[model samples]
Target chain A: MKPAMLYKLVILIGILITGVADAAAHTIIVHPSLKVKNISQALQQAHNGDTILVKQGRYAVANLGIDKSVTLLGEGYPVLDGQMKGDVLIVNVNHVIIKGFHICNTNKGSLRNYAGIRCESVKNIIIENNRFNNTLFPVYLPKTSHSVVRNNVINGSSHENTTAMESGSGIYLWYASDILVDGNSVSGQRDGIYFEFSNGCTVSNNRCKNNYRYGLHFMFSDSNTYIKNIFSDNGAGVAVMYSGHIIMLQNRFEYNWGPAAYGLLLKEINDSRISDNIFGHNTTGIYMESCSRNQFSGNNFNMNGWALNILSDCTGNRFDHNNFTGNTFDVSTNGSPEQNSFDANYWDKYAGYDLNKDGIGDIPYYPVSLYSKIVENIPYAITLFRSFVVSLLDKAERAIPSLIPVSVIDHHPLMQQYRKS
Target chain B: MLKIAKYTVYDIARNKIILSYAIFLLVISLSLFMLDNDPSRSLSSLMSVMLIVIPLVGIIFSTIFIYNNSEFIELLVAQPVKRSYILLADYLGVAGSLSLAYLIGMALPVTIYAPGTTGLYLIVTGIALTFIFTSIAFFCAVISRDKARGIGMALLLWFFFSVVYDGLLMGFLFLFNDYPLEKPVLFFTMFNPIDLARITVMMKMDIAALMGYTGAVYRDFFGTSIGMVFTLILLAIWAVIPLIIAVQIFRKKDL
Candidate 1:
């Protein structure tokens, strides 16, 4: 009843929804030689809807807190150094905009989250085109909504010392809603983008690279879409846990390799759509545990170890029109007697002939081999992976069916590799 | 060559020691399976046993077999038979008998209790190890005329490959700990036959979690068909290359 009501409400009054933009009534220029020595004094003298333009100069200051609805714009990327203290900029009121500032060098406080910019209980905030460097957390928002954070460059400390629990990450959205995070390049943070209890957000076109932990962490967040993001060189990769109705589209996961690493880890995620993504050179391209009702289609998995690893309890997942090429193993899973359909995917391991020349194999291809089953049952059996006898057993199993599970099968295997436009 | 091979196999088949070897494997594998209902656990236990005992028994038995049959080999050399044929036949006879015994002993218990990929892998790797170590034994025997020296050399070779090689690999990794050793260590692993055989079986077992990053790297390398083919070829070369060298050396030696 609620879902239908929402649809009807959107349909009936869709044209009535429009945004009102407020105009700035006052303008002030802040220079080093002016009465306001720095941004803090300028901010103190400013009122609501006022725009303070900061000229280019380096400011060595403590935390700058804003309590009014004002715009703090930098004319030439004014340097705001935190001097190894706390947050460089803190916004406590609504309708604030912090743009074009080069904020850097915040010491990672053990108890508190030291960030380049922190927003508390604020709405309609615009944080854009800023550069953040050597900060523990950058662009952090708590209990805020309807905000935009885009075109930011966030660089953090070396990812090696990421074992600290509270440390790392860029652009953490906590208890926030309807946020737009786009066009950001985040590197060397534990996780590039982390969302906790945030919903209805759109994260797109972000390049997240070389993070020690996950490139993106979506925990307990629902109705979020991550589109066209590139996640590379992060061994912990991307983990989407306890979330539902998420859309992952056209994302590229590459070069995330380690023993426990994977391109994507989906745990307790349901009703999700993973479509048109490229997963290349990862240890395990996609690993799902206790996930159900997920649709995986049009994804390219290339040159990965253990391309798809599904746990025993996962069910009702469908894999269709996905290209599996040059991967070590197409699929490995614990013995799950559940049903999942795999259809029309191009597999380099497919040996069946296309009898009618329709580019579809005449026989159904079993992507799960006997050796994969062995490795699944006994993880230690992974050591025998390169033996001659193992290959011979694979061949023998191909000719003669053995104890390999037959739950997952691609019915209409394509004769050629899948090409997308 | 076929005639000598046939005679050698027939002679080894009637030997009491070979019969006892088959019975020994049967008892050990069956008891291991009976003790544990979980097929994977049993297979792991049997794997360790096979790793240690197979190489030891293979090298020792083949070395003794060659020493005992040196007189027969001399008689064959005096005949119209080629020296290469005599060496090849003797090596094949010992390897074949040992592998056959291994198959008979492991087959019933594995097929009945385990009856899956793990069972099949155990059988296959076990047979390959038998063949490989037996060939190495032939090389040791052919190189030295002293009976005690040949047996001692075979034992030392097994110890070096099974134990020393792994230690050296660990030490090398420790020395280069600062560098990314994942890619280089894979190439280094190919030099040792025991490591190859053990890894082949271990990769099938469920212990990737324990192996962690190193395990994942190994899985990436060995999970492919190409890696499988390469490792198999390497194992085959390990078995055949020594026999080839042994044949070459035996050809010029005085009986």
Candidate 2:
């Protein structure tokens, strides 16, 4: 090749490479005061990988749909009003980014899919730093995958509005996968974070309080990780049902008290890990039914009505290295001869001392008693929990190990408390 | 009366303030609609617009429209026409013009973008809110002797309807948390026009999940044919009550 031609070819290759790189990452600015008259037109004109930056102003428009890989950003509280028509914003594309906008006043129609921001079948989307105010539903993801929803403030104050007919949620994911919801403050809605039929998701570092419904509710969502989240003053702290391979770690479940309140309620869950969580001031700390092979460790059960309520059919579970302190009832199990093991836990009511200084109790502790077993079957018997007859019967049952499960005793119980810090 | 209505519409069309508002709305609405690719996403964006801009235009335009049109009102009163005619004409004129402006500015973009019942509902809501606020401004103008006080009252009314009413309802719920007043709560919500508007539009949108159980009860009660009638009746009251009060005050006023 000629020397000049070779140099030109090299330059052409460099230009092509740069063009490809630029196509992968593009930037678009939406001036706060640019005052564009049509949002649809602007979106239609935008390229697949471009970013739309919206400045601080009220943008009154109708339903917006996202179908391409793009980033939409709002600066200084740019408002997106739905005019009470339908779902405000819907995302149908992959790798899209939405941040920093006040989204509100969504219309709650009987046929509408999601109210605030609905993502359908999209993947690898990021929604962050946004404020959803007075919307019916804040962030809804259906059949989407690999999405990160973080650092968002979702407020749904439907206190006096009778016009809203649907249940509102701060972040609702259904049939989604590989989702991560973290560091969000959600209040005054139905469910703060709800997952149904979702798998392989992580919910962590989120503050979900004062919601009318559950703080974190999952049904048939398997292989999910929940860590370091706070669920306080909601109708229920957390509910896990028909799920497996779930990990619940370092979370705090508090102040979820009502006629039917629980810190954590597990129904038909199997092969899960529940560890390092703090449960306080709930009606029941952990209510389990038909859950098998789940390991419970290093958790603090404090000031709950029943620290552990293991119903019949819950088998092969392990409770170890946990601290049960100041709970109204340590453990209540239905039926005889439980299949689960309770070991190495620090019980506030432990009578045996660790004379050998091995950090393990000398005597095996029977967490379940005949009185508790009776109360489990006839719940009204709980009113006589502190009565002399019940205490005497409980002591007798613990010493004898007759009606309750023989294997339910905490062998090698911890003499010293296990604290997360 | 018809001439006054026509002039009011023409004057608002020519007014620089309204023109700016129309342009601003056009720009923002268009940007929001175009930038969003999902219809549902745009619905949320439009909701933010409605909550902020609807009350803003309703209060600001109505206040200024009343204040600036004081001379025109006085001139009309000086003529031999009925005071009721003058007030009605003024109301129709201002409301019609602003509604027209709102329609042209917002309706066009919404129709082009969504082109569904939702867009049409929004246009109707915007127009309804404009008329409702105009009537409220007339009432304020008739009651207050000073223009400043009148504007102040109008703004306060807007604030109450938009923000404070919801707050007060929450306070009530908190105070009476022990009592189950779900049915009564539905009845109570009907008194606020903003709540009425929210309910009416939401039912149309089919996203009742946002409403919760109480909202569902209300929907069941009011989403029926009878409920539709009741809603229309309430909306009529929203229009008629303020106009009637304004007319009554205008008829006897010394001005």
Candidate 3:
């Protein structure tokens, strides 16, 4: 045969083989009362591309492993209970889809990070529309890439005796990249969603509340985009550490109140965009340490203990067009910030006049009050909050322009609050 | 006692100082509410006004009123009425008139602009401070024979509570910075009606979160209904103890 005919023949044979395999793929139904009573037996009878439909019943499975590229679908939300022994399901191979199952009780008091669904070194996996209850680690992805975990409700057995920090995270991604985590409601875990060394991930629209530790935590995760997430009442709120080029937008961080609580804590972060987020009623809105070159714009810092507790180590960060209202102290710092810029922000405490009616104040607004510095040095001195002497001292400091840091002044303060026009 | 209190109240109500004080408070409250768009900001500004202006007016006005009406008080003391009744009548008249002024001037505007638990608490604390200072002023007036000396002492009392106490507190906190001062500071705040009122009203505002751990302790104590009632009762006690002691001193004194 000629070379052209040989190439066409190879193409035709490849198509025919895939067509036969596609035609041979069929569904295997497994019910509790049926002859094929367990998932392991059903998996033995299933092929690489076959679908296993699990009916509504309790399946006491321990360390169930799925090594094939198959689809595991639940018809009426089957219960896969690990009986607190080990991992419920470990997906080892790629191209797997596990959907609509209630996964629970995966080895809680163990040293190993057992999960309801553990995916190791897998690609193109989809874990969606599932409920995880009383799980150690609800969905643990290690070295997995290009996966989607969406619309899952994960809740730990948040007992009063066990601290949340001792429990596992709802959805944990370690060394995973290019994953999309969306629309999941997570609570009662050490962290609602945890990303460690995971790069190029997209996390959006997740409600993370009442966790013992941070609602969302990112460590060494770079180039990640998390938007429109609500994190409330967590122990320390969200923390992003040692990350760069991350885009955080439109997130709400509220009611994370305590001595050391912060709405968003950034440490050693650089070149990130944090915009349009609301930090309200937190002990501190955004606590930044050794952060540089981050852009914080159009964010609302309202009713927090300290709106932005930017340490002296943080520099080259710019804050513009943000609203600072009802916070006790707009900005507090231990030392003088070097090169941070604040412009066009609306502060409710700005007492400057706008004679030109250009919607900008005529004088530079000094946000760091002397009282805040005193409170920062002596935290207990906050007991004198709203005292006549405190206010009097603040007024005197403002008139003299002394004591507080002069570098953290907003030259063009907005007379009116920033509105998204 | 009621007849005497009624007459004193009427006399104080007709006085020009009380009328001007009421109008002054009304104008300030109205301007504060109208000038700022945010009711919370206005309420906070009004809080500072309440903290400083209320006590100043309460103590000074009451002391001066007592000194000005010394002849009438002496005449009443000489009559068949008891000395305690005379003193209590003066307390009731001054406290009642000052509280009414506060209610009309500050509370009415606050209710119209920012009606909430914080506003209501501010009103209650304002009246409490008024009664507290008025009673203390009666004590000052009863103890001192000269009018100028009594007024000076009243001013000093106001200055000490409003400004100097916090100054000393800040110094103590800075000095003992190594130790945890949350509970100790709370104890100190209890001694001053001004600080107690400030914390009580501050906790209800959104900025209570700014107090951090110290704020949490205050909220745990002052934010609860039972704690609030306890603090109000304490403020009531603050109003009564000084007056009782003054009454005791007045009853045994020679003319």
Candidate 4:
């Protein structure tokens, strides 16, 4: 036979085998008020590639261990109460899907192992459309890969008497990779979504609000894409620490106000891309500390206390094609000889003209004033920020561009405002 | 006084609402223990939930308990029993019952799942909150003539203890972020019940590294036996001061 005919024969055989396997797949229905005494038993009876339908009922089962490649679907909020026995559900199998269940009441253990649903060392898992209500550690993925967690609602209404020192994340991913968390709602937890030592993940289209701590917190996680998410009313917004190759795009960060709160906090991070994001009503729009080689473009920084707070040790970062309007301060820098560049941005404070009609201002706009640098070293100097002496000094510094770094000025700033709506 | 205390305990113990609350807590605590993959993670989750829920339940349950028993209190006051004894009995009875319920609801689950100093710390915190909120509820009852006002006062007290007190402390820290006010702030934070709870749990967990400079300062001063004793004393004061004030007000207030 010819080579093409041999390839066609191989494909035909593969299709037939897969067709037979698909026919063998089973469907198990767990109806509301089903009198199944043991959830584990229901899971045990399910076959590989089976679908277990759990329909609206309260299942007070603790530790429903799932070790099979099966789909568990819940209809109308089937409640799984752990009763503090251990993790509510432990998924230890590949290609397992858990969807649409209200999980609550995770037990407080000493070793920090309690979770509403724990995926340990699993692959190709899908956890979607679930509700973790009043749970301690709601959804924990440790040492897992290629998982998707989507459209889930995780709420942690922690009380003083019941709380333990180690217990509070809504969704925690540690040492995991290639995961996608999308379209979820998390609130009132210590950290809404925590990523530690995880890499190559995507977090998009999620709403995290009113969390006790950070809405999205990552430490030592790299090559992650966070896009189109809404983070609001949290203690702090998205915090990227000690990571690299991060892409933050089109995300809405607002109302994360406190002493050290910020819309996006970059600490010891490098080589990231942050573009097309909306940051408003936060204590600080973007705070960079010890970060380098990052690019920020097409972002809207509005109504924030400080549009950008660049601490010492940040270098080679570029801010261009962004809109900075209605902010208390356009930029606050700590160190002199700023290594970063701010060009082509639309600043509301800019008074420069486009005399040539080239859409670029004739004169450069200095973002970091001498007064801002003084306030960085001595914050109390902020008290005299609007004083005549400080104003004269700022004017002198702008005219000469001596005290502040020359590169920090937006040389080709846009004459017209860029409205991001 | 002892008879009244016994009667209050019996009434709380027999109430279906308290029973359901205890049962609900049991279910939740047990589920939490079962759900967590590691024991330490579960402990932290429990601690977080306890921080918010315990104070809410303590204040609400005590306030409602006091208000609901107003008729019974009037009946007892009509007898020869002194109001002071009656008030003390009511406070003790309410505190004891709530603490007992918490023990059954939360403490047993922590012990079974967490099983360490952290669990013991959680139990102590639960008991402390029960006593503190019970005292605060009695104070509210003594100060306010109307039930709605009394309940509102209890809720405000809860709000102050839970959220506003922390906000004020944070504001002070931000205002004085440049200063080295760690030692004085440590003493100041001890006055707030929520801060005390936070400090106690942080001390037990040995996870002070997460709290930044504040934890470092706390570990520096409060890592010793002297610090522990001071914290315990402050916690004791937190429970006692409100009770003493409530007793004083109850002695003077007309029924």
Candidate 5:
């Protein structure tokens, strides 16, 4: 066939598919208005390309496996109480939509992966605007793609039990691709939003707080974008590990404090961009180990215990145009063969004069202090942090630079806070 | 010994240098507190001054004071007073006077402006530095007969503690920079009193961030109770050993 004929044939196929959908689609209402009393009965009576509209009522249901090209629409936020038996709903087929339901109390299932709603091996679906309570692995999507999980509220496992840290996550995505998880509020789970082996995903505008472990944990997930998310008061804010090509923008990581806790732990991540994030009150903000070629720009590190704990072996990472205010130590590194760049950041500890008035500082700022280096090797020496000797040593070193990673220099430090354009 | 120590303290208390030292401390603390809006920055400013100035004054003042009052010391020695008593009295006199000045000059301002652990830490470290340095001064003064050489020795001691020691540590670290030196460096810090004093305060200030994982490891070793006790005992040793050496020298000296 000619090129034009092939295009016409593709359009004809698209029209035929839509026509078949329109022809087979039916609306099945499960309510007192009809003879059907329960959703299961309505579902049994429905066919492919059907819409099962459930009315407002308490429905005590068993495991629901949806395997059709259907839409399950709930009216007035109908409650689906599982009474602690098994997964409330499971979607085994593709091209499905489940919206506007309140689901709760999914009990122990056989696979140890029983979820409130599990989408297994499904494609082209949308699970939106639902509220979940006490559901392990709520909105679990395994091997899914080209789907959306938006505007949902998940009040996952109770935080009262300390062992809740081992429970399931709020929205778990494994082996998923091109998924957009947006505008969700999740709390009280092992992790609020998790992505494992998921790629090309956009996790944006989520409020994940007070979780048992990490609010957002990304592992082996590549080419993802996380923007405008607030992760706070969790055991740790987020852990992005063994991944690359990540763009983290405009996120707020706050108040994640503990001996082992941190705002963001980036390990073995390469060619990533972390920009415009606010890191506040975290024990260690942005702890990087073995990460390379990452760009950190326009971030605000405020009142954190340790703003940047960039360990040894991290190289080619660029820290530029960030504002460091009131952190205990703005930057720390183990003395090793390392190469990284710190440029044009506004440091509160900068004592250099901008005599030329070009908005950039005339002199460079050494983010690593002398005493910090001493304490790095001799941990007990931190007790002497406030001592005059350490202060003078740091000042003296700052004046006549030596020993402490001279390669990591803020060559063009900003006199003012760097405002992102 | 107590009576002589009391009289010496009173006598040194009235001296112009003691008064000026107190006044200088007062002015610096008050000015630093007033100048920086951030309480932490001001605390840092006060701490550095306390570290550098306190140790220097303790050594210089005690050496000069003891040497200038050699006639008085000889007069006391000529009396029925025990040899140990006279030396102990002069040492107590200088250390007590300096300690009082530091407490009066620093403690009040710190309590008023930046109270809590910060104030308490600064005061404690200031007191330790004072006691340690004065004892060192006493040892240097009693060990050497020439006043000028003694003063030179004291100044050199101050310079070594305050500057050269750190430079040397930096050099040692550079020589062995390739190895994992956290443990060895920590052991090395205990040898220097100034380094010891500095680390104790920094740990308290929670700038452990600077230390990173090394800091956490330090905290694990120190904890709260054990760390403070360790610091106090180390400081006590620093004070007592010097004074004992001074007493030994004083016993054998021909005044």
Candidate 6:
């Protein structure tokens, strides 16, 4: 061959060799009856872009690290028993997918924060259709972005006696941004789906119930949207603390009854839009403290202890076009309300008449009650609930505007409730 | 005793006031149920009405009936019957009629409309309040000779429990705001049948969630079967103690 042709031939051969190698990334089946009995052996045998098909058998593997970009797919949901050891699978590379595996019995202790699947500093990671039982941390991602953790069932404690402090979160995302956590049913964990310093995430269609702590908690996570989620019977429901620009829509919060429990607890949250949500049968439906500039409308507060416990610190929040019905106290504030406007809301306890044939009542409806004020000051006074004296006091207070913060009135109180379309 | 009780029930059944009270209760509950499609909401309105009206009517009517039945008692004392038997018969008659009125009025409507645990709780508390107030009214009647004084004292007792007692409790709670007053407040509630009845029924309502830690304390005490039994026994004691004292007074009186 000529010299230039020899050089072109060498380049062509290199391209062909790389193309053949890329095409050779095939599937490696690992079974109990095979030579490669465990996942770690399969990981060692497989190359990047390869698929490790795990067969239906119990693989007792712990701290199995995947450093290559590969797919670990289980056939018939093979059990990967952590055997009360460390993490079952720790992915250190990007483009890793772990699916259809029963990951169970990770280290229950909180020292190592052992998870069924822990991904660190990776992207395009998909952990889906997996059942994690009794794992301390079901799916933990740290410094990972653009990941999808979907359709995962995580039960922290197989036995009912485990306290939330003893277990870890169902899906813990730390410093991870733009993560999509969807269709997860998380129960018996600490905080079901927790986001700390994770921004611009979307958590939707998740049922986080019966968790010992907040069902879905996001601290210092900004611009996240949580929609169509059901958070019920959790210790403190869902807590959004120190976050801004959060949008929570069409969420159902129910049956979270405790001294400190609330359907949605917002502290230091600003510029949030919480609309079209249903808060029913919670201790406090929405407890906002030090939260400002938030808009809450089209929400139904039903049968809650305090529909909106907006403390004196919350300012500039507008609540309009909402329905407050069957709640004990429509609103309870410690001191005077600070520029929090409430208008066009239907209150069940609004005894004002709409005399002008308009739907709005002529007299402004004050959501705060004297009895609620008394209860706020003296919680023990709640024992006198339904007492003739208390009812009489409430009636007298209503007749004459006294004790309760008059500034927290709904100017255009609706005669009929706002129906959901 | 049964014969005397039967005659008293028959006589009270014929009275216009008792009939009208029953009719009024029926009208209020029926209207409340009709006004709201949600049974729980109607039950809440009905609960407040029942709480206020049941005790007021129970105490006032029982006290006035005892005053009006003084001559009947005098005639009974002339016979071979025991004074305790007459007083017991009067109690049975008054409590039975009032309970029947409540059952027919509130309970019937509640069952028809808001048939649930809350309605059952309301009925139980209403009946318990009826018995308790009647016993208290009987005690008030037997203690005072003047009719005005007897009725006045009964009204005062009602006012104390229904209005003044809670005011005092609110004052105490405010005064001791820094202290943990859940136990003390719960202790104070046991002294008033109205408060007891209110709490018993309040447990069944969604408003109980507002009570927070105090509610948990109450639920711990009142949610269990033991606590329920304890409340029942205490309410029974409240009914019996006043009647026992009234029977002693009636036995010693020179009618």
Best by DockQ: 3
What is the clash tally of candidate 1?
A: 24
Residues A181-220, model 3: lDDT tens digits = 9999999889999999999999999999999899999899
Candidate that beats the other on DockQ, 2 or 6, i.e. the better one: 6
User: Which candidate has the top score in lDDT?
Assistant: 3
lDDT for B8 (candidate 3): 93
Against the hidden true structure, what lDDT does model 6 obtain? Answer: 0.90
Per-candidate DockQ values are 0.09, 0.01, 0.56, 0.01, 0.19, 0.51
lDDT of 4 by residue, B110-177 (tens): 88888887688778877887787788788887788888998898889887776676556555655776
lDDT of 5 by residue, A1-421 (tens): 5999999999999999999888789888887557988887887888887999999988887588887778999999999888888889988888889999999988853467768888888898899999998887888999999999999999876535645535688999999999999999999878999999999999999999998899999899999999999999887678889999999999999888776778999999999999999998887888999999999999999878788889888989998899998787888888653678898999988999899899898988889887767756655454455544566778789989877888778889998888877
Candidate 2 wrongly placed segments (more than 4 Å): A1-28, A31-35, A161-165, A385-393, A400-403, A419-421, B1-255
> Looking at every candidate separately, what fraction of the true A–B Cα contacts under 8 Å does it contain?
0.17, 0.00, 0.62, 0.00, 0.35, 0.69
Give chain A TM for each model in order. Answer: 0.91, 0.90, 0.95, 0.90, 0.91, 0.93
How would you encode candidate 2's per-residue C-alpha lDDT over A286-376 as one tens digit per residue?
8899999999999998766678888868989998889987565688776643688888899866778888899999999887767656645
For model 1, residues B195-218, the per-residue Cα lDDT tens digits are: 777776665663333234457667
Q: Model 5 — interface RMS deviation?
A: 4.3
Q: In model 3, what is the error at residue A381, expressed in angstroms?
A: 0.8
Tens digit per residue, CA lDDT, model 3, B100-184: 8889899999999999998999999999999999988988988998999999999999999999999999999989999988889
How good is the docking of model 4, by CAPRI class?
incorrect
The TM-scores that each candidate's chain B achieves against the reference are 0.95, 0.92, 0.97, 0.93, 0.96, 0.97
lDDT of candidate 4 over A1-421, digit per residue (tens): 6999999999999999998887768777775445544457667787889888887778887887898899888888889998878889998889999988999888875677689999999999999999897777888999999999999998786565433244577789999999999999998888889999999999999999988778989999999999999999887677879999999999999987655678889998899999999998776789889999999999998777678888767889999899987565678776653678888999876767888899999999988778667656544333222333455667788888787866578889997766555
TM-scores of the candidates in the order shown: 0.66, 0.59, 0.95, 0.59, 0.74, 0.95
Predicted chain B of candidate 5, TM-score versus the true chain B? 0.96
Tell me the docking grade of candidate 5: incorrect
Candidate 6 on A1-421: residue-level lDDT in tens? 6999999999999999998987768788999899888788888888899999999999998998899899999999999999988899999999999999999999877578898899998999999999999899999999999999999998878886788789899999999999999999999999999999999899999999999998999899999999999999998888889999999999999988888898999999999999999999988999999999999999999999888898898999999999999998889999997799999999999899988878999998888988889888878878877677777878898889878888898999999999867
Better of 2 and 3 by lDDT: 3
Task: Name model 6 segments beyond 4 Å from true.
Answer: A1-22, B207-211
Which whole-number lDDT from 0 to 100 does residue A11 have in model 1? 72
Clashing pairs in 6: none
